[model samples]
Target: MDLGCNRSGKPKLTATIRRADSIKKGCPFMLKGRFDRVGNFWKLQVVNETHNHEPFVFKEGHAYLRRMFDEEVDMVARLHMGGLKTQRIVSLLCKWFPGACVIDKDIYNLIEKLKKEIIVGDTPMQVHVFEFDLL
Candidate 1:
């Protein structure tokens, strides 16, 4: 796992080290909290990792997933020439995906990713937007 520094200045590795027992009991695959030292006392932050709490790789994974979904959404949007109802579009995708799961959060993430890319208006946006629109 990537044990990089977090926004609160506590590195992920330190959290893992401190809360290894709790995580082992709960979900070893999760990095859900942090360890803080205030003078001579140490405190364990048992907060679950929210979307914003996620580290670099988590964000990258979401970005990659968002790109994939955006491509699909863009294709559908162009096919119908407008925005689509949430359920109708999801139903269409589900037909092809079968057991695959696409939730509201996934759609929101994709939209956010697309908007950010559009706002950036960089070379990546040019390539990805064209590809998405075409497909």
Candidate 2:
């Protein structure tokens, strides 16, 4: 789960539960909660508690379960390719997608995946010779 401030300056928390290998293809379990400032406490809520398929063991390195959309990923890759730092990219994303729950690590992972997909080279010297292309 990641915690961040929403557009209205209120704290928001979100979490996503990926489907198991046995489950059918569909949207992952998702939950979004917000803090009630007047109530002076956190208000947790389940956005999608019921799974469309069966449950199984959780897998590792499921970056696709992230809340970011495909277009957002492309934008992040573009920004990173354009020389923006991870921190700066995060700030920009936060501003651009207020309801989105993104973290520095997510952007870092996206950049890594983008690099892996775009810039491929057999030798070390050949690295960085490929042009930027959004996947």
Candidate 3:
């Protein structure tokens, strides 16, 4: 998973690491929390504090594991075209998919790829020229 940033610009920390079957490292630490009405604040209770496997101390990935669904790409294009910044796009994506994390570089890369598809490549240029000729 890619590193995530919070409102204070600090890297968000998590114990849960999703890994493939070949490199599975399991950590059995869980924190279940709820709001306490009496204190009017949140309270956290640790369900299990045993470490079966190593937890990730530093997050490192090129977002290769994140599979961008077709609808997500479409949303990226639409939001980018609507003048939303990449950070906002990432935030929106996280909000839209609660269990998912999005990295801005991926959005940037996707935008560049989409631009290439629509801009002056041989096929794209030929189609644009053909349309112009028709006009």
Which is the leading candidate under TM-score?
Answer: 3
Worst lDDT 10-window in candidate 2 = 4-13
Per residue, candidate 1 scores C-alpha lDDT tens digits across 12-90 of 4544535632111222222433345455554444344433343355443332333444457674445333566656656
| Residue range 46-85, candidate 2, lDDT tens digits | 7655554454344223344446897788889789778888
Clashing pairs in 1: none
**Structural similarity to truth (TM-score) of each candidate:** 0.34, 0.45, 0.46
Candidate 3 lDDT over residue span 18-121, tens digit each: 73322323444566778888989977777766655454443424254455888889999899877789999999988897655568888989987876676655
- lDDT agreement with native, every candidate: 0.49, 0.62, 0.66
> Candidate 2: where are CA atoms >4 Å away?
1-66, 128-135
Clashing pairs in 2: none
Winner on TM-score (2 vs 3): 3
TM-score for candidate 1, residues paired by index = 0.34
Top of the candidates by lDDT? 3
Give the per-residue Cα lDDT of candidate 1 at 99: 40
